[model samples]
Target: MNNTSVEKNLANKTVFPILFAISFSHLLNDTIQSLIPAIYPVIKHTFSLSFSQIGLITLVFQLSSSLLQPFVGLYTDKKPQPYSLALGMSFTLTGLVLLSLSANYHMMLLSVALVGLGSSIFHPEASRIAHSASGGKRGLAQSIFQLGGNAGSSLGPLLAAWIIVPYGQFSVIWFSTIALLAIIILTFVGNWYKGMVGVIKKNSHSITAISPFSKRKVVFSVSILLVLIFSKYFYMASLTSYFTFYMIDKFHVSVQSSQFYLFVFLFSVAAGTLIGGPVGDRFGRKYVIWFSILGTAPFALLLPHANLFWTTVLIVPIGVILASAFSAILVYAQELIPGKVGLVAGLFFGFAFGMGGIGSAIMGKLADETSISHVFFLCSFLPLIGLLTGLLPNIEGDRKKIKSNK
Candidate 1:
């Protein structure tokens, strides 16, 4: 590619609406998931929630999302379409709006469940679409889309901090609904409706549906990936759960200060996701995954030791390392089960991450009984799973043997 050609390619890249939708939907979904932890204290105090009940609320979101993702993936992989993507975002956006409006625990749980289901539909489909639209730049496209989630996750708390005080949590819903409505408009204007439906009907490839019980190689790879997934989730849930508390308890920072730092951590995640994809594309996906995982261990181990005013410089990198793993590994997991991208997305994102939330609750309960530092210690050791992942045989992102037929 010449300089002029490359420049044109880059310019053309900016005009893909399908890519925009995928990223926009991701931002909305992740904001909903990540924002809850920050606001839980407010809700807990209002509803008189105990520690376990708080964990249960988080667990409910993960469980429903995890359980529903596989079905969504199955349907999506079998028939890739844009409607599912649009519909999923609409559902997720609607759920977030409802979340802000909830007056009771039951209503909150119900709202979370909707967000979970909506997310379930969006992730796999958006990923698949991004990969397809990438036109051989799958890594960059995936990275861009992945960044949306991180961006939303980061923005959610900051927005909540601003809006929740004067207007309340329900006010956040208007933001999601309005943003989603724009995506809906963009979806039609971008002509994603006809394009995606056409693509779905065009798919006629045979996907190898290997049962995990029988395929040791695939299952073992999946099991190893699950370990990575679990560790990532622990980092996600535990960090969000206690980060503000840690700041207040250890550094004597005020609630507002701690929350700002927490937002910074999330924003770092957005940066990591945006960077990881291109790095993966330029290097190798395996290298990106393994390096980030290994890089995280030292950070995790060192988190408790940062006591000084300037130590947060160290904390930001740790957050990036922890967050970047998802974008790379998520794509890697989908690639592992080439013909079953949706199922794999569901299994990795929904199931493994869901199970991780349960594990996180256990750690939370342990914190209640034991020392929170001990919980962090246990969390640190979980990254050892990443070392083991290096041993799994790598796989291609898609079934090249069948692409010609498609």
Candidate 2:
């Protein structure tokens, strides 16, 4: 019943089945979400949309995705919602159906917004579940969970190329099947989450804990993490929202070919995602964060100047290095504010989305004003902001040492 015993119990209670279930659901959820961006070229051509309009569509989707996550996480921290995951997927299903039927740009926005809302609902609670099942391997758990999303993201363009590009917009309804399967899977996850809540309630007395750092230190650390998120996601916004267009514009590649190229980058991201968490768990998150964020700089700086062959080669390392930071960053923030896992996840995730949205909107306008090539050249410097990593406190290293001593 004591704190030590409770800690041991929680540490030893990592439930891999639940972890895998939640991670699978994450994959399904993100795969559905990525479909929006995947079909952008089709939508642009069909609707005669400007680059600005394209950006606005992303703005709407990203805003809807980002704005509500913190509130959802904060609310659920107080009142856990086991079945919210399934309910969220229903929104995505509806969105996918609506996207297929949409006749106008406005309707497209509405459909994407619905999908974004589903994501807002899904992430916080699912993240909490991952944290609970971490079994003292929080970074690895987060990495597993995130690997699903990155993989899902990689799948989106391939699926779009195969399904939407050739068959046209209405074919999108086929993807609703993905959402349906996610709903069924999430229902099971919800049941497990509900049971976990009951167990937590039974052991509530032994679960009390406090942040190891002072509030000011925690706040400072969280700020630094947010900056890192800003750097990572903003740069990501450029790649995710415009990389295809860049490829097409610069190299005159076919849309399908661009999608394939994008897939290469995103697949690299998935591969890199698997590395950060376990590495952070073993070596310390601060080091992982420093290396992951700053390490991408050389490749990013070189990307805008590279030819088609070299561009293809460079993006792989760029994706791999840059993609590793999020899991480490998220887990570090969670550690800084120990008991507020849901809140930390929501804040960081939401901010990342918000930055991506904002960055997309701005870059869209920039591309409109100048060119996609110029936009990439400008964003090449964003990774240099990773120098701020020097300011982050070294809590993870200290914790690892303590654990080793114990």
Candidate 3:
């Protein structure tokens, strides 16, 4: 059969069972990943680590996660790996064991890198699975997949506060059960993936239709998307890596109280993520992208100036608005590139990780040199870059109309 015919057949088959499986695995995977950041205060106090040291920990973890992802995606694009996800989770299990046993700062960094390595392996291929299972509902599929990670992220601080903070660093070992659960789940996903590959092999030709836009236009559009990602993830780096610190510094809140506030912001992120995909599917992703990123400007600008109560209130909107852009952005990019789903997912995910890492490190240095308040003020302007959303081509109009008609 021709590529178009194969595309149609695949598009008609939305596999919810596999989607939910992968989404659940994603929750387990990210919950493990989020623990690294969530316990920063505990580790900082335990080891008497500096802010730069904390940033370096993120840098190491994120670099390990980011640097290998594109290569893994590229390799897998040519040669699909059905069982790699399960194997990847094993690495995470080992990392968790090591983290619990870590004696000092260096050990913690090494431990996190192993966890990062597992993440690098998991995301690109799992994303391909999501795409395969998407049928025609790419936005909703990506959103469902992302919602798990966001929810898991929201859970980390609370988990840390309840389990790790009260019980101490040794309590990290308790969470290793989550990794084992993911391994078993991913093993099942791998089986489903194996079956799906056979179907693709039987019916589909390698995807090679020329993109509607010229190569130059595609490159320019991707550049704009990457810039938007940088703006989003960099701003996120400030919040994710340092927001707890900011709360403690500015409000004199206790560590546990700061974590609770962090949980609120992250929960809002989960809620926003759930909304972005369906909305993007209904409307044009471009409009959703525009609103998701640029819409946060007012709240983001206000966050730094707010007093304690208002600061708490403001993060809800900030999290919701900023969190919405990613699903739209990922789906938009996939549409632009057509068949390079693995590569595209890898590049965007990797770049997002890289940007977040770099942002954390830079902000860490800035915070050390100046203050956390100054860092927030500087990041408030990052969202203004969203004005460039106007530059994205109007590619989704036909899809939007079709979706509307249905």
Candidate 4:
């Protein structure tokens, strides 16, 4: 079959369901990860943890995820996406379960580590499968997949709050129960892969020859995308860790009000996710990415100045839209290295994102020193570096150029 026919068949047969499965798994994974910070304050108080000790929780989580991701990526290259994905989800479910049952901070930390390791496995494998199914439309595919996670992260805090508000400390257990149930359902009812036979077979022999070090374009693209995505991850972690507290402490918003504003941010993310995928597919991925980054800076600066509920409401959407920028960058990374989709996905979204959490750990320390308000403004502008990198050139899917030298 011709490339166009193959592309069409892949899209029609495989794309949406796999993306949904990947998204669903990611949604559950990210929800728990996002809730960690919110849970931290309570846990710290309960356990009498020092500031450094509390920060170590994130440090350990990110370190474990980052360390394991490249290896996961290597394994994903050789394995079936479903196997890796299922294993990752299993790890996540197991970790959350352990966390639910934990009475001490050490056990809680171990649970977080388990969740991080599971995430390291899931992201690259699922993303590679999605990218292969997408033909060359990596950005749109990733955007759709990541939109699910953004929605999950956005929803998790509010959900945790709602449950915890009524049940207090026991709410974490309930969260784990929900994740466990979802895993069980997904395991049996999952239709995440429908036509993987052709797609996987076409690339079955390709992974052995794929090496990021040999491909200059892949290396350069990964480096640039890493910086771009790192900024996004740092912002996400910061928002997850600090935004609710910021609203409560700095703006004097009540906990309920703070949670409500978080929901506003999430709503905007959902809107951005819906908008980003189609827009990236149509008008070009670069514009969507640059737009999200350049656009978000002004909103970041405006956030500290906003006093009223309405003002906060407006800025939340800006943050949400900006969060969706990952869709463009991630897609770009995958397309830049076609055959090594798993490696690229793992490096960009998994390892790089974990590194971003490390950056957020530093940001958290900075928040302790200066104000998060001031630090966040600077973080907002960091995406500009990414915007500039996107302007470099279009090298994606240009195999003719790559093979021309031969």
What's the CA RMSD of model 1 in angstroms? 5.4
- Model 4 lDDT tens row, 126-177: 6766666565555667776777777777776687667754465566766776
**Clash count, candidate 1:** 1
Give the lDDT of residue 97 in candidate 1: 78
Ranking by TM-score: 2, 3, 4, 1
lDDT of 3 by residue, 1-406 (tens): 9966765686568889988999999889988888888999999999998888889999998988898888888888778899999988999999999999999888888999999899999999998888888877989999999988898898899999899989999999999999999999999989988877866544335544456678999999999999999999999999989999999999899999999999999999988997788899888789989999999999999999999899989999999988889989998888888777788888999999989999998988899999999999999999999999999998876546756898
The deviation in Å at residue 221 for candidate 4 is 3.1
lDDT of each: 0.69, 0.89, 0.89, 0.66
Determine which window of 10 residues in candidate 4 has minimal summed lDDT: 185-194
Candidate 3 RMSD to the real structure: 3.1
In candidate 3, which residue pairs clash?
none
| Shift of residue 355 alpha carbon in model 1, Å | 3.6
lDDT by residue (1-406, candidate 2, tens digit) is 9966775586558788888888888888888888888898999999999989999988999899889998999898878899999999999899889999999999999999999999999999899989878777888999999999999998999998998999999998998888999999999988877877755544443554466678898888789889889989989999988999999999999999999999999999999998999999898888999999999999999999999999999999999999899999998888787667778888889899989999999999999999999999999999988898899888856666867998
Question: Clashing residue pairs in candidate 2, if any?
Answer: none
TM-score (all chains, Cα) for each model: 0.84, 0.95, 0.95, 0.85
TM-score, structure 4 vs. true:
0.85
Listed per candidate, the RMSD to the true structure in angstroms reads 5.4, 2.4, 3.1, 3.9
